[model samples]
Target: MTESTTPGTASGIREFRMPDVGEGLTEAEILKWYVQPGDTVADGQVVCEVETAKAAVELPIPFDGTVHELRFPEGTTVDVGTVIITVATGAGGAPAESAAVREAAGSAGAVAAGDQAAPSAPAASDEEIEPEGRQPVLVGYGVSASSTKRRPRKPQAAPSVPGQPGAAEGGPRRPEAAAIQAEFNGHAAVVEGPTGVAGAAPAAVRPGGRPAGSAAPSVPGGRPLAKPPVRKLAKDLGIDLATVTPTGPDGIITREDVHAAASAVSVVPAPEAAALAEPVPAAAGPAREIRIPIKGVRKATAQAMVASAFTAPHVTEFITVDVTRTMKLVQELKQDPDMAGLRINPLLLVAKALLLAIRRNPEVNAAWDEANQEIVRKEYVNLGIAAATPRGLIVPNIKDAQAKTLPELASALGELVSTAREGKTSPAAMQGGTVTITNVGVFGVDTGTPILNPGESAILAFGAVKLQPWVHKGKVKPRQVTTLALSFDHRLVDGELGSKVLADIAAVLEQPKRLMTWS
Candidate 1:
């Protein structure tokens, strides 16, 4: 990913566009913005972090300037080449430009302040409680400031006469009470029909505790009077809007009214729960279920895994091996002067073993090109290590693992794992791998049928290393043992070829001395 700056709408201002962070990727979600609008930023300062389908990457500003605006807020996915932020190339930003921006903003800030008297400046004492007069809207949007413009009070429609043209019903006249607007604690509210309107009218209730005394505004077909948000809330809770009472101005159903109806019909109430109002209270009942939207790395991982699982014919072969000798070697290598300060673990040796095994059975390290009806054999190994990060599972590969010495491979492995854990692995670090290894052993798992990484032919699942009774040298003895499972794409690797690869890896692990001879 590269950051570039282009001349903005105004002079001395540069707009920074969201860069294509991965090969062929068209968009990235803004995970966070480190700098807010109006903050001073220097050249090369990391302003935000973004997540592409492949990995999370930090984007740095390309030039020194004061942040003029953050075009998008966090959690927004932006298309590549779209301008995401603008900067003013002045030490503290030019006053003229700032003034121009404010003029463009107009009363949007007052709306964002969410108060009645937002246009007036607040006293120093009030500033501690209220926000500044010139507050920015959600990413500085004018239309989204939530205008304080109230709808005009809908006049009571002339009562529909029975048997008249366009009368709703031709039956006897139903006595509907007149709607009465009331002030409840200094707020304007309209009470619906009086408690005597009909069945289930909710007991002569409050206009401050007296049942509503007026007719409500209704649609031509009598579908009930509710705003879109209130209707959505009722639908989500499985509440019928027609059953809810209207306590809002102009006979409109409210969110609180729906909650009150819901509480009235609840089958059970917890002993600790209490009705804070006449009947409206956020039910203290524990939620039955919760839903989360899948996105970012986790969503991408799921898509790739599903594709690989169904597209590739996988065959997993397992073998249990004694690694007592290998375990002893790991300890001795830790003390060796040449290996000092280097990572010395069984996984390092396991990786080396796998590399050697691939060399012996090169056919297993190839891909099936169905479109061309050809087999693509790879001469070099770009080894992938499956890492579990907070975002999801990611397999970042070492560029050329077969040619690296033991110390070099160890250092690379350490760096790869650390970068993944820190959520800093770049998209390029995770591409172009011939094979992968997943160390399920770290979690004490015995074995698993590991899935192949998309585009790769094989994967290895390494199980926990533990002391077990084993037949060794014609005798049963306590030995350090572990299970290894190798899964390969059957179309590319036959059972015989897969078996040989698995056997080779087990042999090297069983006899560490074989690493020198095999290589």
Candidate 2:
């Protein structure tokens, strides 16, 4: 296990390295493996599913071959550029040496489990294969040579017992002999002494009256059982897991347990102590205390939000407008023959209006590049629609959204929503976004100052559309109205530019015919 060996043959072996499934993600966990040894696989066939920090992605093999070996087991987190599986292209079964190599690879993976400090083996030079006439490459991924090396195992020492001095270090004793001595002599077992009287061996009784020296029982480690996020919470609160009493299933330390421990040590004011002692009935439930591991989509979203909030100077502007005409247009589109079987909703027109606004005020559709100290203006728009899924919030955008017609945009939006709801959104679809629109209207919220998505300059929040009293043409009447809030990075977009973009969107929604003239 000390040496990194390639798990393939010399002639016709291909090692499929773990690709970076997200934007510069360094590692991913192998959730499941679809193919095993001796299975025939074709090009573009999905071989495995991996969960990165963003989303769960399925990796497709690029070439046709028989599965030779899977280097790492499922649930093992593998670094990008490391080989996870190998395929054999030869006509026959794998060579005898390849089988031995597969066994060695499995042993190495087991020895390195749960130990991130373990060194990995270097990529095998002989196992690297180049297809004839073309260099192989994965889209949005680059090939790099890397490996994991294993640390040598250390020998286990005998457990030293208290109050015993040089008792049983002589040699190994037979269990049967010890049992016979206990039965016939009606006394505890004793080991032979060194030129002296027989001495009783230090025998610690285990459960069920078995001697500890007969069979060593496995003892759990001192580290408490808790998820990564729970451990992080405990660290942040300066709470020690070993000191807290665990009430969770399997003796696992939960977030609530950590919080309770923190509250116990905190100094409370005399006035609030009586109020805090009263238990709130609303918090009572079997599932009220839930601990979710902050990983995958949720973890990435949190990190991005923090970076965007602190790094950019955010300016939020709100405007309330009458959108009665836009709702009429939605109903008209749903009745149109060409728009049949397509999703037609208020959000669709809102998105189109935002795109048109960007066209009018192109300066707002830009990102501030701090590294280059320049404003990067985008000519075409990659309109990002923020969708909340069961896993977390993900913003998947349509590529070249400015060029799409209304019907095309509607179709793309429908597909995007469906894919996100199913939790099958690819990482590429979530990248290269220039602007975003978050529809808080669906949740019946009036409006909100939404934080900008990372790498984007502006974000528009579409609020709930409600019929309210308004003055129209100097007459008081009930009209369909909605509130819109636009948040932008002040560094690249000033107050004037941001206001123009917001005003343009409000005008188009108020007067539906303006979309034709404005475009």
Candidate 3:
């Protein structure tokens, strides 16, 4: 039968291309599929959930129709404009159910290649003929490209008039089996009927799952029972729709219900339970071949680092300084009544020092645009703080950070870190950063020349602060000393400019009052 005769064929099939669902995010990992083959969908309806570099986003279908096919399985990383799904648009928007006939229309070489790769199955003995329809699912998955071709259906044989011997088990079971198999290959097989007649039951029910009693009632509500986001919420919250009461107007499960369930279960901390119950080190190698798919933030960082390392002419300068006053300020801030409930740390002071340094050298707070053939000097700073998240290195920045006070910057930094660790930072928070500061001190590292984040002018590395011998008042004294490494795009800032910026940062850390004088 022509696809036009299929309900799914009612609407002509249109392939939906993956869009930049996240803000300027070019690609995404298919986290889950909300609709499957044979499911009806509406325009603007979310059909799939994709995880962008920063957050997970639901991809909405642009056309209304039955889903004809899924181009790729879940967890596949698809670039923008890649066709991920095809929706049927011809037969009243209903998709035609596909038949299950195995046709070898491909070249013999192609079929042989596929068969060779097929998982090994028990070989049939020479005395016994292999079962006709016993091919495993793996074999079907490896079918040749031409195996998708469908042939015209042969005419159905005349129905048995009365108690006629069937073609099965010395009875008429062949005809019935033929009818059912014909649905897939358009060719009939013989099978015994209920009364050992040639044709009693018109269709053979596949064993397993409940016997097909009647067709599922068409949902009168018209709305989809669940949407992409709702389905995701259900899965994350572990709420089974089979039990959750539908409060939606048309008996559909609304986002509210999904959210309510999610909120209810969210407090239970399933991950925490699993982590505590069985403390297995994920870093250790295990059996069954553990594979960490390259995607999300880790993938984006890799791509960006590659681009930046090759494109930017980088120049790094390092200096060691006594940040004793900065450490003392942190202690005072922690005990200050005005700064109560605020997180105080050396990073905050380092951030303040960096801000002052940026003010000293705006050249460091700019971008080199080879395309425009111009140096783009950012008037406002989207200050990125490099955070090492579980996903990977993510630098979520604060917009117009040059405008924020030390206290405000501290709070923003805290929120940024928390949001990044939770994988909730939006793409907006990760883009448009003019400069960045990576706190390698948290890991007790001394210092290293960090690579510039792609498209930015510079990145500063903050080394671990510790008591070290330093000349104070011409006397060697133990002081809180740390190293600051400034890596800048040489094309934009020469050594003189880069060194001056790094010096200004070290000077401020050496004597905190210098910030007040500079500001």
Candidate 4:
């Protein structure tokens, strides 16, 4: 709050500046303030959290001092460098001798000691320090250049123990008892999972006065009831099932009820059907050539691929996998209530398989740089999905993809695809990609020796899904299968290393359960 110094010189007051709130947000609207006049703040304390267009970010105080004044009021739009709060620092308390303050204050830049007032000095001298690398100290106002920091939480008053109903305890409530009660009463049932959905199944009920187990009359002022899934579909689409006439067997609602309900709500796009509905629109320009801007992800990818291609003596490896078990798992997952509403494409399985394979052969994920004279091996997976958008090719990765569960990975893949399609992907999202998977299969291509995204040692190409004749259980039969192509920088990766990585991926696809086994 106060510090001692020369008669005219005083301790400098520091101001905390607001940070770039959003990823690319240049300005923010100050939503509200937690501190006001006369509030004591510690360093790295969050005084206010501001909301940007995308998300809310908390701004922290840079210095520990008493709040002097809030320059801008709440709801005011502020630029980055604008100082939001001020703290008065000096030796003596508020009212002090003006002579001592002048003696304490040196130039206007450094606050004078003794008096609470920073010495009144020439403003011209303050401008000289800007180029010298010494940041200007506030005359009790302005924010610093650093982002806000979080403060430690203070202890709260203790609560009474559950069993010891009357007596107060000096500690937190007995966690064990509450945990036991939670387990027994299935309180955890209501707890939402990482997917943000509650886990408990809804209670079952029968129509009319009779329970589901009872032998109820078929036509006692009754109508056939739709299944839970069907009912849910109808509710989601705002469809009134009572108004619709059922033409199902025995006049019972069928799967058609849900399909009809969904279609009535919104028509889903069928890419293949749309293609057949009209001839493909040729570009107004020449069909032989399409130019794309070399910027952002595409530019970065081109640079990396070219560097990897020329720098790392490249070697490619391929493997044809039956993936019969993987296909079977996809079918099983479609029926799974947990995996419902997810895109159960082969690429999802391939991503899981690649993650499993990475765990087994972590060396394949390494990068080689002769110029830097270094080989970088990363422990975490920033799994990049090579997406071909209308603009150009972009590989935006899901950060920490290896740490996510299969369902989480599927969800992330869906988001990445959606984000890329919407052209809302951030430039930061496309950087620092460790390993990549190109789903060439989407374009109906069998396989291609895909280029390795620069910085990564290897890339896995997932080919088109197809049913082909193959040997299964030592017998010839038709089975769902696909080919996996792996391209690697031979400079850093070798034939043995590439083979192990490819084989591990194929093994997981051969018996999707191998994922659990390897991981």
lDDT of 1 at 197: 26
Candidate 4 C-alpha error for residue 246, in Å? 69
**Model 1, CA-based lDDT:** 0.71
- List RMSD in Å for every model shown: 10.4, 12.9, 15.4, 28.8
Off by over 4 Å in 1: 1-12, 90-286
Q: How much does candidate 1 score in TM-score?
A: 0.69
Best by lDDT: 1
lDDT tens digits, residues 251-298, model 2? 345566777776655333467543432222332223323343466778
The backbone clash count of each candidate, in order, is: 6, 7, 36, 29
- Write candidate 1's Cα lDDT for 89-205 as tens digits: 855454222322342333333223322342253322222232433433333222133334322222223245666653443222222221221211112232233321223222223
Q: What stretches of model 4 exceed 4 Å from their correct place? A: 1-300
TM-score of each: 0.69, 0.65, 0.58, 0.45
Compute the lDDT of residue 111 as modeled in candidate 3.
24
Q: Which runs in model 3 stand beyond 4 Å of their true positions?
A: 1-17, 23-26, 32-49, 53-55, 58-73, 79-292
Writing each residue's lDDT as its tens digit, candidate 3 over 1-519 gives: 001222222356676777776656677787789988889889889888888876666778876778976765565566776667777765755442221111111122222332343234233222212223222222212212233443332222334445564423344333334434433432222233455543433232222211112211112221123434445546645564433334442233555665454443322244564222222232333333323446787788888899999999989999999989889988998988877777689988888888889988887788887988999888888888998877688888989888998778878888898888876677777878889999999999999989999889989999999889999999999999999999999999999999899999999999999979999
Q: List the candidate numbers ranked by lDDT, top first.
A: 1, 2, 3, 4
- lDDT of candidate 1 at residue 384, scale 0 to 100: 98
Residue 298, candidate 4: alpha-carbon lDDT: 42
The local distance difference test score of each candidate is 0.71, 0.70, 0.65, 0.59
